[model samples]
Target: MTARNQGGCDGEHVCRIVDRAGEHFPGSRGKGLTARTQEVLDDLGVVDEVLHFGFRHLPHRRYLDGDQVAEADPHAQRTPTPDRPYDGGLLIPQWRIERILRTRLAEHGVRVELAAGLAEFSQSANGVHAVLDTGERVAARYMVGCDGGRSTVRKALGVRFEGETKEQAMLLGDVELSGLEPDAWYQWTVRGRGFLALCPFRHERSWQLQAVPFSDLGAEGSFPEPSLPYFRRIVDDLAGGNGIRLSKASWLSTYRVNVRMADRFRVGRVLLAGDAAHVHPPAGGLGMNTGIQDAYNLGWKLAMVCSGARQSLLDSYQEERLPVAAWTLGVSAEGLPRVAERFVNGGSTDIADGAPSDGQQLELGYPASSLSVGGDAESGPRAGDRAPDAPCVDSSGTLRRLFDAFRGPHFTLLGFGESCAGPLRDVGTAQRGLVKPVWVGAPGSGADLVDVEGHARTAYGVTGDTLVLVRPDGYLALRAPGASRTAVRDYLDRVGVSRSA
Candidate 1:
């Protein structure tokens, strides 16, 4: 549901989301939201609602040469951790997520103007000037292009989209059909023809179809048009027409494998995000997830800058995310071949079959960024690592998790011992609601947060009087070994986190 829309503004319709499509329709076949992505939704306060509409994982039932059903679980071996609550991905339709996000936005008086598109935009010292497809004008402080691949914003920035388009092409659509059981995802791969997969939508009554026809529609090697009639013929040809009827297409799209990324993510006041920043093979279900990550990382930084933080904070967006985009390109490049091989050898369930262990993305860290600072500590999470979670008790003997402390739009100053109390109070007072300091120790030892089962200490690898400063996005910005307030304060000052040392 990530669009080629304009985002980032407020009040008097100053910032608007301009979508080129006239209506809200599910557009892509990507529906996997990984564990790391769930963390982002948790911070935004919508993970429970999303979970209500999604399933743990769907089994892939493959049909080889029109017979013999083979069933496999893509996420069978994964398990949840004290630190990583979500193990794999949740399978829900794209439209459901879009609706949830839109509803959340509307609660804050944010309006999404449908049937409107970003015709063009220009950046000036004062701000940004934009013209919509409806011939309306908009003025804003900054602009972010959350648009998809083939984005108008990326093109306008003259950012070189460096990569190659694959020789293989595909037909993807959502439709109404009968004679197919919705119990498991159905896949078919004949001798030389490519594979076909039908995944039932968890929320909707329809199913998503992705396949390669290889039938002659015209020219030398051109693919067939994504029409209901053509899909019917192909399905019939492959299944021998076992009374499986196809009709009324709700959505249809042609997918050409494109692995590309922008040379740079920003230019002046205008910046690029999501598919506008990177596009990859649908393998690993990384296209939509990567775009969502882009938005999550940019959202807070943009908010801070708008509230008058230093401009350099926005520059870190490019520094930290560009490397991740490069990593995504590599994973997708290797994954497509595994999926392609499945058509011949029956190795995969869907396009997402080839993703490696790290696809959960829970371990993704920004160790090299300028924002990550301090310590030559031998063990524990280093600066820029994702903050781990552990179950614990509050001073009132109430059960809580480390995530409960880090949930909102504020920093968490976790002191491993009572000796760090002075720095904690000072930081809490200085940053006000921006920083919350929580002490971890035994009850009545003057520790507000008790490590009930020693899970917090073990998870953090804490063996001493240490202090870790977690960013609003849940990554550690500073991890000082000696509970030094000076260390914490100096690091915050450098990152433009308000409050001088």
Candidate 2:
């Protein structure tokens, strides 16, 4: 099926598409958290228009104390034009996504559109149809449900989303704080008034603040926040004697904690992806990143399946991403109670104390199921490792880098000196559908990078004419001290990327 990029009232519905279009890719290195996120998206080539069909009529607002927050253009806050590295939202800016998607997707040959409601969907042979919300029903052999926590498609299929909603309700508000430095994240915890965290806001000279709980009002208080005094009190206590002031209240709402995961991610022609399959608390900022990873894992697999590259390639998606998602849910579950405990006791965790591990981004290895080589052997930084990106030099005797070749979809083979070039090149091209080799350093450069007296060799271990084959996902598939055709073939067979395509 042709990819449709347009939908959502204005062009704003495509923010996710634009947010990741060129953000994540090989060779595109970035500094700071937000830029890193963009590079991740760019490397993955998630260049498509994202559709924002989440419950719209559900009371959305962007408030500014007395600043008149403007109309619901939908296209306003679509793309994340990140200005700094440490801008403090757990993930990308929590608001104005669709607007960015509109602009980003257009460049990738996709359009954004907004539709009112779901009119129909595709069902199965037991009286099922292959269609969706729009009246135009197109039948496809496969369907993946990415709909959200309350998934309509999952329910229709009789799949259960099991989990409990937390009894503790929070009065959440996003506000701007004045008289505070724009350079850092400020947080203050109050005894009975709830907690407040202040951080930078994108675009304008405003800051974003959140006041949790706001009040001790029971869940029966009907909707939290008509109780402005309670919220103000929390803000007041958090400010302490510092005389801090807050204004430009943005969104004020209530959220009940929830954690859930689908019993199964796939059933026949339909599959589950992102929140449609699992939902968890907003701790650690894993929610959105997890969903984006889900998209990444599935996108390439789907492309392969649709392109007829391999049939078994499709099943690996669930095998690879499901367990990772499950582990993420587990980690998130562990974090929720710890957060509450910290709030209740006024005790600081390692995070609150500014520990080194606080902001270290998570990088997960592809699961054993996703391993393409050395299945039973030792794990990590071995054959079948995501070839790390580092600086290096070319055969021209000039300093370049390793990531330059790792960017797009090309077979990457690495070797040390001129002696191994003929063998490496011969072995790489010996097979028509597999393997491509590239030499690093120059002829007679005194063996591999180990002898070069630089960071490049130390980074990639080019010591003594090592030969390494890297996979498309940046992992190393094989490493040999010398050129070995048998070793290369064995590594290829182990990873299912054999010469016998």
Candidate 3:
């Protein structure tokens, strides 16, 4: 793979890349990943890698304004239980996440070629041809621009990036700190001044520092360059005394808050994702998570299309993701001013407090996409909703989660209750490798596996005869009542899945 910047998490220009190893940062400004995103990472087989790197299960978030302090609700820390694996969220460092992704890609025999910038590119009916800054030419059937907000690919495509950049800028960096507990995140605000926050990093004596200047300070001709002295001065002004000391600094940069999105995610065969597609403030910590989901939403469709599926499958990428990007932009933009106002007034700046439940991205779906079909309009998880996970027993009597059955890159046919068994079997037989059928029911009900406590049934909101066809990306493609193998096959056929396969 050709990358415009250096390889690994240290790529400066890339939004996903992190410069430090063994350094910890808030996964999402302390809100963490929703159980849904965690499930997706687990499906990709990288969740374990992140855990192996030692993750901090933050118990509480503390906000400090001068002498006043407020603790977040203890219930806010609740995550999904084991039985409902898709329900909770996690907190892990971006660096560790980057390492896990890089490791996984390497295991697949893919290598990143760093500093190979895309200078120019064009596409024809056959494929896209790209020219690198090194005078190299490469061709591919599709291209995705994951570059940051100032993307050359998006610029070259002439996709209008719509939104505005705030007049104020925020400063972020990793620095060495003293006399602070690493267990809880710390935020300090000064009335009519500004705000400063320090969250524990992965390594000892390290913290991720974030500071937003007051309007008066920000309005000054130009922002000062980020340096040790400048950071120390700000810290002294905002978080002085209390035995806090900012000894040294590593990475530092000034960023203007922007809420912009590409008018079109795709121009011909070239597509955009991440900051290249949308840019927004970091209030809800939605930037990185949104980008990751964008790739996840597009990856399987891209694979199917490249493997001879209908070109229309690629169209769903933008259809499904663009709306999501727009929603996220709106959420972050709405939350930005609140957060900024809180900072200036020395009030609660907890982003989670201002963020909506959908900010976790669990509720996001492609309900109106062309790929979704056949489901009850008013009951249960209809087509295009995320497939929830519940506990189940496998054929070997081994206890497993519904996610275990939906783990791989194949469609899953879930037969809820005994009445749909024959149709599920028939669909499984006809689809074979293209789909995996699992019979869900009470234990000893002669089904493939028992829903046992009926968690699966309850979670799926299924009773009597119901069949849910889950797409490879873990979204409901079809949810039909009664036994109808035709319905299953028709839905598969619509998505270009061969029944005979």
Which structure among the candidates has the greatest TM-score?
1
lDDT of 1 by residue, 189-297 (tens): 8767657778886666788888776554234435766789988877887766457788768888888888899999988888888888898887777777788888777
Error of 3 at 191 (Å): 1.1
lDDT accuracy of residue 467 in candidate 3: 87
Candidate 3, residue 470: Cα displacement in angstroms equals 0.5
- Each model's lDDT: 0.78, 0.50, 0.72
What lDDT tens digits, residue by residue, belong to model 3 across residues 3-30? 2221222112221121211343333232
- Put down candidate 2 lDDT per residue, 362-481, tens digits, no spaces: 345463655455332332256533455555555545654455555554456777556566657676677443456666664365433322344444555555766676655555656665
Clashes by residue pair, model 1 = 3-147, 4-147
- Model 3 per-residue lDDT at 265: 88
Rank ordering of all candidates by TM-score, starting from the highest: 1, 3, 2
Q: What TM-score would candidate 2 get against the native?
A: 0.70
Query: What order do you get sorting by lDDT, best first?
Result: 1, 3, 2
Error of 2 at 443 (Å): 7.2
Prediction RMSDs, each to the true structure: 3.0, 10.3, 5.2
